[model samples]
Target: MRKGRGRRAVLAVLFTAGAVLLLGPGAGAGAGGPGSVRQDGERPSFRLRTHEPHTITPDEGDSIPPLTPAFGNTGPVAAPLGVALRVTVTDARFDTIALDTIPRNCYLAKYHRTLICEFSDAVPAGAAYELAEPLPKVSGDYYAVNGSYTYSVWPLGDPPAHTEDYTAQYERGKDTAVGLKPVAMSTLKGDGESTGDGEDTGDGEGTGDGEAKGGGEAKGGGELRFVSDGYADRADWGIEGIKLRGRIGEYAEASIPEPTGAAQRVRVEVPEGTSFAPLTRQEREGLPSEIDYCTRDAEDGNIYCSNPRWYVTLRVRIDRRVEGAEGRISVAEPGNGDTNPGNNTAPIKLEVEDGPTSIDRWVPPVSGFPVEHDVPLETAGSDDLASPPEPSVISVDGRTGVILLVAGASAVTLALEAFRRIRRARNRGGRRVTP
Candidate 1:
């Protein structure tokens, strides 16, 4: 009976404490935060796979689901990328889908069809996200919404000696193609009859479309004008290990839009005493298919792609490490082809100020990554640096902290009250009370 009484008292206290803990103000918000970031023990890389666009309507009520974007990351730490998905929703039939007040974390551009949305939280590597959007009432036209997630990465230095701005002009690719002309423009003859387009020999004039001289089919011919196809979120931290000791090697990547359209060159200008170095056997094997075709130009030692392609990802790396060396790698100016000179020539620094002795081995060309889709850290702050995290570092959100404190206090008070009741019962020559 004594044991039964003790058990009853224990159960009552535990239940009361748990209730107090959960009822604390603003609870449950931290349940799915960074604490949930997964560490799958894989090399840090980004693979963004898009699903076939689907349609949602107000008829579906509050059941509009988020997109299951196949965006994965295999990095060291799990932190918010401040990543936003810019979705361009257009009315396929009338071009009148206005961007107005939207749902959770989504904002609209005043005069554009773009809707920018921030997800619930930072996603870990190898995970997928279902992005949210507002549903419309009309069903006359299907919307074609497209966009990409843009984020940044920089060096890891304590009391960071330097923080690179990495402006959009230097990082992102602008007008991909230029000088694209048409072969001929349709024109009309003096007799008021339709004639084939006027021959366009670099002169910008368009003649009317013409039917063949006598009812035969007239084929129109012209040069295809280059246009922007997709968003160039322009950033790849590269896949490789960084060893601090004898030689330090790494990769820098550029995200360009198209493969076959423009003239693009990837130049890796290393610091003095360090030219574009060699890659290991493993590194050579995992290179995207275009390595052989886009090798270093014998004339200038940079990789040039005159006959551009879609498969060759813009991955530039210096394989061999140089002891205690630091410099920046530059993607040389891509001549006339990249009309927007703004993003043509960007430089990235490869700093080894504080050394990492050994880096994790990464065998790239990871299986299951889509051929083209296969694309792709921050330092700690001063206070965090000065006072290192201790073993007993208790990290908790405000709500969680409050809940724990309340629970602890309740448990202590219950225990004291129960003990007093038991003592009074025993002194009165009766069985000790459990309450």
Candidate 2:
């Protein structure tokens, strides 16, 4: 096999995340019921499946179909929590990562050689998260190179599988970690009418018991909004500052309650090519709590969650080979004093794909988010993924980024257009031509 040279494989990772509200109905919710803060509630089992085998040609303009591997909350009613996911590239010339739908929070970093993905929050119980992004990458060449990555997930804080700091994965032994859609629901519907918790148009007033009994509708709701710059074709360039917005509000009839650490634990998720950046001193001051960084030890970088009144915003920047983002985020914490736990957690559906973007938006944000989302990259039938390809290097001139390869030549030549032009003219004129 020809040893194709390209860019260095900077051990990269794709991330997914979800929130686990510690105050499960099974546990006590009042101040002293179950030690809501320390419960750790039981961690749920995670099931990860690969997509079917697919072939493609990678080129500059061709947007290749992104490999979508999905992880499901196959466990029972456990507090929402984050999981650790890993993708092992075993086999092509190069590959890129992107997310159409995103998690509550996700961060991407270069591992030794492979991508180590971790989520900020937890995967919801019995919730199915499929990556909403189509994940299309155009071909840079005509070679039908096969690319693949093996994905695995484990509970974020699981014993022998977790670290105090997420970045600890770099120095310490490999530790695993931990969406989307854009689902905007104003309120629940019963028999096609807004029968939330309150409201009566003179015809008949809505009662909590009636609405809850007649239709299994939720009392309160929220929205998930994500903005991403389209994926990049080149390896040198990257996408930056993808915006993640999560707003927790009530459906008109829903009652408001006092804020608690639960409000501080609201989460935001991101995808593989994206990761959270360090928070600024000012941003940190306005944040609610450090739930995001609560688990991290000294050396491990961490960012805390905020206790916002109704909204939280997170910024994720592009690493490399990132096209779009797709994922979901919602409040999974125990509600302040709600009789019905039905509205405790709500899932939104969202997905974003490749599109034209402004030059200014090309760079994503420098901030990072915790893992937690509804985005799941999926493949139907049996999960059959192509083995990940090997890494390569690409050399470009500052001006032209042009490289010339001579057949059977040992030396690889890299030169700019100016150098080539001067050389060409010199060869033709042989000192006869004057500048």
**Residue-wise C-alpha lDDT for candidate 2, range 61-157, written one tens digit per residue:** 3333444545455356443445444433322212333322222233333432233344545566655454454222223222222234444444444
The lDDT per prediction is 0.33, 0.32
Score every model by TM-score: 0.21, 0.25
Which stretch of 10 consecutive residues in model 1 shows the poorest summed lDDT?
152-161
Best by lDDT: 1
TM-score of 1: 0.21
How well is each residue in 1-435 modelled by candidate 1, as lDDT tens digits? 887588667868766666556565434433321222323242232222323323334454322233222233323433344333333333211122332324434444443333333443554543433322222222222121122222111111100112111121111212111111111112211233333432211111223243211001112311111112221222321211222122223344433333222223344444332333344568769876565323454534564432235343334343333345453323332222334444544443344333422344212222221121111112334442232223344445765686687776777677677767767766787656898
TM-score of 2: 0.25
